[model samples]
Target: MFYFDATYVLLIPAILLSFWAQAKISSAFNNYSEVRSINGYTGADAARKLLDANGLYDVPIEVIPGKLTDHYDPANRVLRLSEEVYYGSSVASIGVAAHETGHAFQHKQHYVPLEIRNSIVPAVNLSSNASWILFFIGMIFSIPFLARIGVVLFAAVVVFHLITLPVEFNASSRALKLLESRGILYGDEVKGARKVLSAAALTYVAAALMAISQLIRLIIISRDRD
Candidate 1:
């Protein structure tokens, strides 16, 4: 019955877009990953160069397992890079690495959106876990008030997704600019990095759309029960 729900009409396009975005990122990353940067600097090296240039000597780069699992941990002030991006000298690798480093820069500079997103993380986690439980239980028991609460809570997820768009775009923009200005990647190599980052950005856009669509579905379902 859940799978057969009528509201899925609102979800299908976002779902399809999510699939397409994933495919685009995979293809773009894999393709550009093969094209080595002219300077032959590994992803780790690029990250180190950026951090050092910014006088962030305390932030260490760690080797994290899995492909494309790279991220910046603000709490510990560390850069965690996936195996491919950590050791790779390819354009995609450095681009991804630089992107993560960009987060550290944002953290140091106190970017407002990043700060707000971090602050809301606890509530978002609670809302994500409990929203569905409340919605389903309310629907089962015919309690419209509880169902309305669920929809409101679910809206938090959409807000989080919306906030993520600017954070992601800013990081990618910083990465590309730093890569070019510092000569980490040059000429057509920067183009490859841009392609990779652009494809990656689409995934966030797709996620935001999916979150919005899901929120709409929840609202419609809640209202129908009223």
Candidate 2:
């Protein structure tokens, strides 16, 4: 509930523009994906092909319920695709599936950045949920110590966001290079896939920026404490 300053106002437009750009990119990729398939394969099929091609056939691909809920869990070596992403035969699906497969490939190679990011997951998960709760309680009770605890907890979230960036970027980079080199996507399709992955990457960037902004806000609030 803080007033918007010049810096925040500038950031608001930047974030909004990025979101708008991403929406356009996503819509374009979704349409292109639905219209074209490298081998006329579904998302599941594409993912399997990529995994097998990389000698990662042991990686399992499963369909979960939802839209755009696809993710790869290195721990279980499972590539979870949402119903739409798993079954749909679209350029978007192919791109997404390939992107996730990239993560699997990274794991196979023991990618260091991913290893670091994965290592912090539990701590990040715990902190993101706990921080605001602690901050609220501390504020309500007029206790500086609880607010300080919230500050510490939020630090974990900021760190997590920073760590996530490289992991995501590398995954997308791997996907793009693989798609192009393997002819998984042709000319326009390659461009579209790049757009899709790039836009998707921005969401993470936005999340990190938001986390940083919130951390700054919290610090400002702490400074105002009597």
Q: Give the residue spans of candidate 1 off by over 4 A.
A: 1-3
Encode model 1's per-residue lDDT on 43-145: one tens digit a residue.
9999999999988889999999998899999888989999999999999999999999999999999999999998899999999988998998888888988
Clashing pairs in 1: none
Residue pairs clashing, model 2 = 33-90, 33-91, 33-92, 34-90
- Candidate 1 worst ten-residue window by lDDT: 1-10
Q: Write down the lDDT of every candidate, Cα atoms only.
A: 0.93, 0.80
The sequence of per-residue lDDT tens digits that candidate 2 reaches over residues 1-226 is: 3333334544574477568766866676667656666567787887887888899978889999876789999889999998877887777888888899988998999899789888988988898889988887876678878877898899889988888889889988988888778777777777877778887888888878878777876766755663
Residue 12's lDDT in candidate 2: 73
Please give each candidate's TM-score: 0.98, 0.88
Off by over 4 Å in 2: 1-22
